[model samples]
Target chain A: MRYIASAVFVIGVFVIVTAVTTQHAAKLDPYMYDYMIENFEDDTHAKNAVAAILLDYRMYDTMFEALILLTAIIGMKQFLPGAADLRARDELESVDQTEATGEQSSERPSE
Target chain B: MSGPVSDTMPTDESIVLQMVVGLLYPFMLLFGFYVILNGHYTPGGGFQGGSVLASLFVARYVVYPVDDTDTETLHSIQRVFLALIVIAPSAVLFTGVIARNPEFRSLYLTTMDVLIGVQVGFGLGVAVLRFAFFQGVGKTWHL
Candidate 1:
């Protein structure tokens, strides 16, 4: 039952993405591409046009990409089996007296 | 007690794996740095270089499992790198520093690439090691 549900969900997503991309996809504008290729070196002082776009022209996107990476790390630290143990020793010490033992036991019963 | 209290790699006594990784680790690191440093001039950049470097940690874990990594330190360093990644560009972009000295633009690009590379490399290394440690626990939480 779970497999069937997952399969249905996956197929639905695939169909939706395919439909959206094929029918409603935005057309590419060649202006930005031409501008970046022609002016990136002079504007950004980088030899690579792609690098110039990523680091200079479209920097905010890269910043958000880094933030997303950090968020993933944070999320994993919070939800993983030994999540509590990911905290720094000093932080743990300040927060709890018993957990300061500095030993991580994944099998510890829930409080 | 079954799970590692600290970051630990799982190891085996396979000589071939150990020998091959021992030979390959340093080169991978060198290549990762090369890719990051030459990002503006070459096809590679921060994300690609960072993943390459992170693969070194994963390779090391496969070769010899041990407590070689300090997760807390990596975590702290990654945070710092992320801050620098944000601040470096913002400082230059907003303050018109790059405009004042056009020669500084390339330098800024390289610096941003390095900061991003470090952030990504450390972030992934910490994640993989922590996941390995989590798996070592041999049990899962119900909640």
Candidate 2:
């Protein structure tokens, strides 16, 4: 039963991907590349056409890419065993050490 | 608490490896910066350059595993870079400044590239350092 369900799910995903790719290819205008090449400098003011495409023409994608990096770091922090706890304890130890030294210095002048 | 792991791995035995990496370090850093700064005029961009920069940490580990990095500070700064990455483009897009001044387009492209390069470099560097610490090598901080 599990094998049949897994096979059916894989086939469904493949069909969806193929249909989307074919539809996308049929709708794409070949001359769009020519247009970008001719006017990218004027439109985006980038010397490199690829830079113009990445930073100007498709900027939202780059923004979300940064977001993904941030999210990955946050998630990794949660999984690393005892790392956060150790960092917190180190900070606390520094604070307590400072306080203890301060008390010793103050008591010495009075004594 | 954990056992007293040495602050730095015993790397004094390998003088040749240390010298070689020390010689190559600055050049690799300069190349990474060049790739990022010249992204507007070249094939390389932020992601590629950032990975190059992050590789320096791995190299440092290979030579001497030292948990000298302030991951807390790096964590904060990387998030700030992400915020700038999101804000800079949206501000330009919404304020319609680029439409009024074509020159701003070049400046914006350069800024985004630098911001992204720094963000990725620091983020990946922090991840690698954290992983190293998790492996029980830090002398002071136990994990």
Candidate 3:
């Protein structure tokens, strides 16, 4: 029974993905590339069509891609212990030592 | 802290040395941003920019001794900036899912650029600090 259920779930996902891809394929216009290439000179002044496409037409995409790089850094910092905690403890120790010295100096005459 | 151990001493010369070292930080930071902003048109992009930004820490270390500059406080600031690096890209990715655009392939590039910049910067900074403070040995300091 479990095998049958698993098989059915897999099949259902496959069908959904296939349907979506087919729908997208139908909507794609091949001629749009030619149109972009023809107008590339007048608008962006970029020599490479690919550069024009990326920087001008798809600038937003480029921005988000940069964000992805940022996220990875964050993730690494979170997951890795690194030297952050060690550095913090060192500061606390120094502070504690200073306070202890101050207390001893004040009490020296009284004792 | 007593009588200035040679290791802990901030010599008079070191002060002048630190000031000179500090002068170069802004330029390094600005260059990183320049690389990031022009990445779309030029050879470098966010990854390079992030690295350039992170290099500022290294510049600081080289100019001033770690003991003189309070490494502990700097670590906290590093954590906050690193967190921003992680959260920003995730937010972008989450937007794509909410919008239900499975074919939103363009989102990948933006996220990649930002995260790479952050990773390069943070990674380089941390690596430099770790190696420097630890003296390239695997021994861990208890702080």
For lDDT, candidate 2 versus 3, the one ahead is 2
Question: Once superposed on the true structure, which residue ranges of model 2 sit more than 4 Å away at CA?
Answer: A1-27, A82-111, B1-9, B137-143
In terms of docking quality, how is candidate 1 classified? acceptable
> How close to the true structure is residue B2 of candidate 3, measured as C-alpha lDDT?
41
| DockQ of each candidate relative to the true complex | 0.42, 0.54, 0.05
Off by over 4 Å in 3: A1-111, B1-5, B11-19, B67-112, B135-143
Decreasing DockQ order of the candidates: 2, 1, 3
Q: Write the per-residue lDDT of candidate 3 for residues A1-111, one digit (tens) a residue.
A: 999999999999999999999888765686988889898645554444654565456656755554464454456546554455655766677768877777655644453
Give the lDDT of residue A98 in candidate 2.
Answer: 74
Whole-model Cα lDDT of every candidate shown, in order = 0.81, 0.81, 0.57
Model 2 lDDT, residue B44, Cα = 78
Error of 1 at A53 (Å): 0.6
- Candidate 3 structure quality by residue, lDDT tens digits, B1-143: 34323343334335666777678777887888777655545667665787788778766655544433333444455455556545654564445552354344344444444545655566566555655665312222221
Model 1 misses residue A43 by how many Å? 0.7
